[model samples]
Target chain A: MARVRERAKMRSTVRAGSGAAARGPRTLYDKIWDAHVVRDYDDGSSLIFVDRHLVHEVSSAQAFEGLRRAGRTVRRPDLTLAMPDHNLPTTARTGADGRRLPVADPQSAAQLDALARNVAATAIPYFDATAPEQGIVHVVGPEQGFTLPGSVLACGDSHTAAHGALGALGIGIGTSEVEHVLATQTLRLNRSRAMAVRVDGTPGFGVAPKDVILAIIARIGASGGIGHVIEYRGSTFDAMSVEGRLTVANMSIEAGARAGLFAPDERVFAYLKGRPMAPSGAEWDAALAQWRTLRSDPGARFDKSVAIDATAIAPSVTWGTSPQHVVPITGRVPSPDSFADPVQREAAARSLEYMALLPGQRMEDVAIENIFIGSCTNSRIEDLRAAAAVVRGRRVAAGVRQALVVPGSGLVRRQGEAEGLDRIFREAGFEWREPGCSACLGMNPDTVPAGERCASTANRNFMGRQGPGARTHLLSPAMAAAAAIRGRLTDVRTLMAEAGMGETQMGEAQMGETGA
Target chain B: MTLIRVEGRAYPLGRANVDTDMIIASEWLKTISREGLGKGAFAALRHDPANVFDDPAFAGAAILIAGENFGCGSSREHAAWAMADMGVRVVIAVSLSDIFASNAFKNGVLAVCLPADAVAHLLDAVRGGAGIAVDLEAQAVRCGGRTFAFAIDAFRRRCLMEGLDEIALTLADAEGIAAHEGRVAVDAPWLAMAGRRA
Candidate 1:
């Protein structure tokens, strides 16, 4: 009761400080929107300032070309960070003599060259392929503290939503929006309606953070987050480390959300404190005071609210093409008739046919030939450690043709190597590779073969996402490692029991200072 | 963007939750330019003999019709560019993804959302050799003696009819952006601290 009263006082204080005409109670989205809105248009859209921009290769080439076509320079080059990820090879980037090897794929080389030239021409900071900081844009942003609380961050890649885990308003944009941000440093856009997803109970043992998000997506369905920016709240997110929160938030796009966000807290402050780009000294103190206020007021209203029982979430995996077609690892593949709607039922039937599974087939009986334990979603040090725990003493199943572990960033790779995870994976017969979004989207040489099944930690399981006719079952890193061990979709609980490892052990991979 | 009205035989490929990856493959995205994406549009779907996107009757369709959550995944604008390159001027769906809608709008393609019944009705009409028309000026979709009204943001509607470059339009408000940056410098000076160069 006293806590409620304190929240009420805080709401009133927030209203008083905000220059807006005293909004009653504002959600975190509202507060961020109000702070960044530059000018409101007559059409109910506003030009909101973007504080940071991360530019990558695949979706940014046309955007830079657009800037050149219009003869416009980057409005705020300091606010922009550029790197190549989508097309770069995850294999060794340097040759035997330590000189950078030329990208084998001509198209990938051209795209990378375009990004390098664009960043060079505009004077925006860039990390080359061999740079320690070069990695997935979404992974690189928060690692360097380039993504901060209450700021708007835009990137051409959809996984830009990952930054929202740090309490920043991260928006994924198309090439056109990228061009707009490059030229104006502001997006002329309407604010997305707010949706809050609060998890109430504790996750059971063996249920990884990846399972939590997959469960949320399954519960909400594919388009549940359309036209909305979802806020991750409740005890679950509060307990989740920055890496875990990032894994969840990165996949929000798969739910069709404009972005996924969390309110800034002490954990966030500790994560950002002493980073390369984070403010230091007195400025850090000032930023901390302001960041502390970047939360939703009590009694704040959201356009939609979803509640999930965390205990109900099991180590989950997608049996079909879409992310929404997820089921617990212990469950059986469902029949299309199970869906009440004709459209969903039809889609299910098509997916089932494509996946070559019968309606009542046991998920564990479904054999997977490949395993991918990395992507923007589950490629952090913690994720790598979780997979390592499952693979520590075991060898990859003979039926499992290939299992690959690619870290999210170069630093994450080095961190995993430092912790001796590379040895565990390599000893388990898993290919421990460099970072660069390997086999996740199949843009590079590391593609899963057609007519094969893969248990991937990547967010999307869309048909042909891994490769044409490559069936992907999305699961947690531990679950993927378990699948690699079993050569089929198996429950991670039994494996966790075998390893005597609790889920809590997965959360121990610490990211101290970047340079430290 | 000059797309006030688009009248054509709507391609009846009404699959729900059509992802951008399904529309265009990742291999096709490694281009520095946006042109020549039509060949790769629905490349995966076209590999299936039963896929309706390659139906002879719907070849070079100026308007495409689909079910809800169309363009559900990925923020890649190549989906929109590919559709436009295929001569698609409008996409009518039960509902459209937010990023897809913005991308389509910026690339001179109209994304119109209507009720499921209306979309189903239009799909049936188009499959039966009837031409459908999306009139942005009237804010309505007309086909086979029936019309369905749609709601679109006025600014987006204006941008479609007038076809203004969005960057040029936003640059006109430079004063407003500068003013906001000035306020940030005073209120939160730490926010502007960028990382060191490599």
Candidate 2:
């Protein structure tokens, strides 16, 4: 505690001496990025310091081996945190007897074992499979408060943008860059152009952060954000909770953006107030004061700007392999002939064939075999509660082959169980599994069968991302629950109406349809 | 990185939005080794026996012409590794994802950006069995005597030409980094001890 207080005090003092007030108008990314530049190169590249580094099992093994081969140690092992999530089985083997199951896949077991050995040898902080904090690296970073406001965080995984919800500059790096950071604690990168995506008004009923992000991706195609960092602004983001903001930022990469962030606010401060790694007492106040200055100044210039009306966004689902190939849940599948771009038209034809959908078929009519309601994108307690509310007294539809709900982390699992959310899921015929990245990338035992269609709450919808030859439609937790209940891609609003859960109970705004 | 000008038959795999996941599926990422990835390159498309990578016409091609936003998904360096493994030295597209371009450069592969029209012309030439040549020194690509210029960062071009990796670049300024660290140790002792044991 003394050390923590001293570090906080030192940070506070440093901020006092720096020219914080006299700086010109700057975007949130600009502010955090400028603070972390250790050296700037003449060729528009800089060796920027990374405050925190998150690592996972699948991508870090080679990086650690590279470090070993070079006869060098981690430059800052204390700042690095490791965990195994991608290759773990979500199902329990003891059948309620609580006997832990050994990992059955030899390859997965070997990956985890290598990670364990690497962490132990380097003395880096790690959360093992049995550790309470074990979870996806993106989820664990924010929950542990290692992703503090105004810090720069990097990870080998692409969803590291999820950390940007706390007003930090979070970036995804490749294995080679991971090794670079491990040896030098800095990344040499060329600065990216700045973009502002301003969303206003309230979202409609059944519309979620997932819908808003998907709608954004639909409006601006996958390549719209190339070579840029996006800042999500305006009233809708202001009204959203930190969890919702995280979901939106998590998929920024899907639109080809380097990173996405929301400015810190009172809600952000409240969320981090007592997190395990958050500062305490005077240190908290000092950090809050610093965070308050992290927002964008009025009239800050952005290279590109886009405006979105949140009321126009509906419950969305992807019809094609790319996240940009999404349509409103109530809409019909688009004909490839409708696309003006030749490339998009060809891609659409391929996607339609792979998805086995007709051009004029209603999205709600598309049958689904599996429903996955967990991932780093939407596996928090709030996500679970939203899903539980939809499945409280319901049963899975007859044709729905499987319904699985895996929490984001053990802590999230315990919280949901305390609230009886797990019971609600199980009673509704949904399998309540332990926390890990289950079926998100299908790197483990939990996989969507080949040639089957699944409604998933994960971020990406690329071809075979969930499993070999598996078709995935990305949606929200509530929408996944509705699909499980209807055995098709049904809108949550219609299900809520059937359940007599009025719009007020849904706690989401309602608006008329605005055509895509 | 050896600065050998690429001159060979080019494969026209001009599909847009070809993400890294399509290049190499996540299922193939369990192995720590970067070997044998060439077999998995374009695995999804390879399922079709007539895919360009496997077509006898494009076999042993060192250049690939792809559509816009090539390699857009995931931060997997395996995408670049797979291309390198398959003996692809250059990829010409309308644009490349930032991470993918960086990975390609690090793995000794060249990612060249051209206008959609230029890419289309190249695709036509490749379909006609004409050879493609990329001249880094001239920053131009030639196809059947038609020259097209492409822009590249001078520093990156120099690194590619000189076979310099990031480690070598950083080591070039090792003395400067040490001096900066020494200054930071005094100015912010807390940050200096961030990675040090108490």
Best by TM-score: 1
- Residues A1-516, candidate 2, lDDT per residue (tens digit)? 665566456544544444344556878888887666666777767777777898888888888898898887787787788888888888763446666567888878888888999999988898888788888888888887778888889998788888888987899988888888888888888878899999988787788888889988898889998899999998888888788889999989888899998999997899887777666676667678778999888978899999999988999999999999999999999999999989899999999998888898999999999999999999988788777878879999999889999999889988999999999999989999888999888788788888899999999888889887899999999999999998999999888888888655554421222232
- Compute the interface RMSD for candidate 2: 4.1
Model 1: runs farther than 4 Å from truth?
A1-22, A503-516
- For A1-516, candidate 1 gives per-residue lDDT tens digits of 665566446444533544444667889888888888787777888888899999888888898888888889889998999888888888898989999899988989999998899899999999889999888888888989899999999998888889999999999999999999999999988878899999865677777888889988998888999999999998777777898889889988888899999998888899888878888888889999999899999999899999997768888889898999998888999999999999999999999988988998889899989999988898988898888988999999999998999898999999999999999999999998878888889889988889999999999889999888899999999899999998999998888787787545643342221121
Can you list each candidate's DockQ? 0.58, 0.44
**Which numbered prediction scores highest in lDDT against the true structure?**
1
Model 2, residue B81: distance off in Å is 1.2
Model 2 Cα shift for residue A125 (angstroms): 0.3
TM-scores of all candidate predictions against the true structure = 0.96, 0.93
The alpha-carbon lDDT assigned to residue A185 of candidate 2 equals 80
- Determine which window of 10 residues in candidate 1 chain A has minimal summed lDDT: A507-516
